[model samples]
Target: MAALRTKIIACPTVGEELRSLLPDGFVLEMLAYGLHNVPENLHAQLQASIDATGPEFGTILLGYGLCANAILGLNSRRFRLVIPRADDCITLFLGSRREYLRQLSLAPGTFFLTKGWIECGEDPYTEYCALRTRYGHEKAHKITRRYIQNYTRLALIDSGSYESEAYRKYARMVADYFDLTFEEIPGSNELLGKLLSGEWDKGFAVIPPGQVVARDLFYGPEGMP
Candidate 1:
């Protein structure tokens, strides 16, 4: 049988990483970063994008994780869907589920940041600034504190896809402002490289046409419903 024609539909949150390693000939479509704020909306947008994709493409690569179960129940009547087996994009940045789990174990209260996140202005710090503009500084500080009360650290994942000086400065400022420990973690593009190279292996979920994405695909036999 002939190889399938593949296209990638990804969240803009990982746009830089994807572009850095993307192979030739594959078209990449990046959705808006704001969709992640609402899982339901993200799910709806993904399903719509899949359903509306041209039939010329036989497979669609989703550059997303379970994403708060946003990808769950997504189905394509005309194409196969390929997704990374990750709880979130942070796993992709870290390069594997094991690494992501390890980081979680080390710092369960960490709030992770990446270049894309900083560039998109979606982090808590950005929200705090916006709130400070409308509300007073004291109120914004209280609100921001409430939002990150449980977070004890701010971890910036350095993927090396781009320079980190400016982003690092911003992350540190946010960390200092919130009185959280600041740390920079080395990131990898191994999993993303594999995804773009069709190295499905056990790290990816390759859903067949008409099949819905399920928790088990990402979490294995012991997956929770």
Candidate 2:
């Protein structure tokens, strides 16, 4: 049999994490962040990337969660699309849906941060600053406040792979600036590792050839693939 041809098309956050773990011969493509605001455009771009991969890779592994159904109705005619059963990238970073759920239950009002998210400069503070710059201080302050009113805590996920004093300090500073309860949480690469290792379980939604990815796949087997 030929080698398992695989490509990981992921959000930049998880894509950067995978860069350190994936072995030789894997095609890795990291898409731009900030597309969360435009789901339709993001989905189109994602599908374009998938289709652009051509027939060289037999499998396309997505480094994303449900992500507001960004991948809903995506057609995977060229190769099978395997995605982790997650609501968002937080689940992938935390290692499992259960852990994410626990965090969710513990802190319903949370702003999750990671090294990637921090380095990307797309946090709420950044948005606030951009808004302040473009829309003036008063308007920016009003909108930014309303934008993040629901979040009371900021939890930084320290994956232990890319820990740096600089990022941690920024995280703390953001917490202070936002007046949020700051906490540090451990992150795991177990899920992403298994994803690159071709270890498919019920936690993964494997869309075979000839079938487009449905919204239900994001919910796992119980939700249907």
Candidate 3:
């Protein structure tokens, strides 16, 4: 039998991590990080990408989580779709939904950061800086505080895909700027590795062709199973 042809569609926030483990010949498409700001737009772009994928590929591996229901209705037209069983990219970084929940239990108000997030300027610190440019320091500070008022800690997830010194420095700065505690946590590529290697196990949702993604695939009706 011929080897299966696979492609990867991923959010930019988790692109670097996925790329680090991607096998040769597998095509990877990194969508805009900004799409995350609106789940509807993200859903549309993802569906469009999936729809445009050629029929030659046997499988599409999505490097995404439920993502605020963005994947809720994504359809797999002619190929199987594999998605991580996670709430968001944070679970991808932390390696599993269990670890993500454990960390959340420790600090429900914690904010997570990764190399991709820092490089993309997707964190609150970047927003604060941008706002400061438009509204000056005092006003920007107030607004930024209001935005992240519930966050008590800033965590940098080190997935070991790359060196962390620089990203850690930035995370620390952000935490200090916001008067939040800063901590470095170990991250795992285990989930991404499993996804890339076809270890679909219970950690993933393997959707058949012609099927639309449903919330129950990632979580039960009440929430995470």
Per-prediction TM-score: 0.94, 0.93, 0.96
Query: Residue-wise lDDT of candidate 3 within 81-197, one digit each (tens)?
Result: 999888898998998888999999999999999999999998898998899999999999899999999999999999888999999999999999899999999999988999999
* lDDT of model 2 at position 99: 90
Candidates, ranked, TM-score: 3, 1, 2
Stretches of candidate 3 exceeding 4 Å from the true structure? 221-225
Tens digit of lDDT per residue, candidate 1, span 58-146?
88999998889999999998898989888889999999888888998999999999998898996788989999999989999899999
**C-alpha lDDT of all candidate models, in order:** 0.89, 0.85, 0.90
Instruction: Report the poorest 10 consecutive residues by lDDT, candidate 2.
Output: 216-225
Number of clashes in every candidate structure? 0, 0, 0
Clashes of 1: 0
Question: What TM-score quantifies how close candidate 1 is to the native fold?
Answer: 0.94
Q: After superposition, how far is residue 97 of candidate 2 from its true place, in Å?
A: 1.0
Clashing pairs in 2: none
**Cα RMSD, each candidate:** 2.1, 1.9, 1.6
Instruction: Please estimate how well model 2 matches the true structure, expressed as its whole-model Cα lDDT.
Output: 0.85
* Model 2 stretches with alpha carbons more than 4 Å out: 1-4
Query: Which residue pairs clash in candidate 1?
Result: none
Which candidate, 1 or 3, has the higher TM-score? 3
Best by TM-score: 3
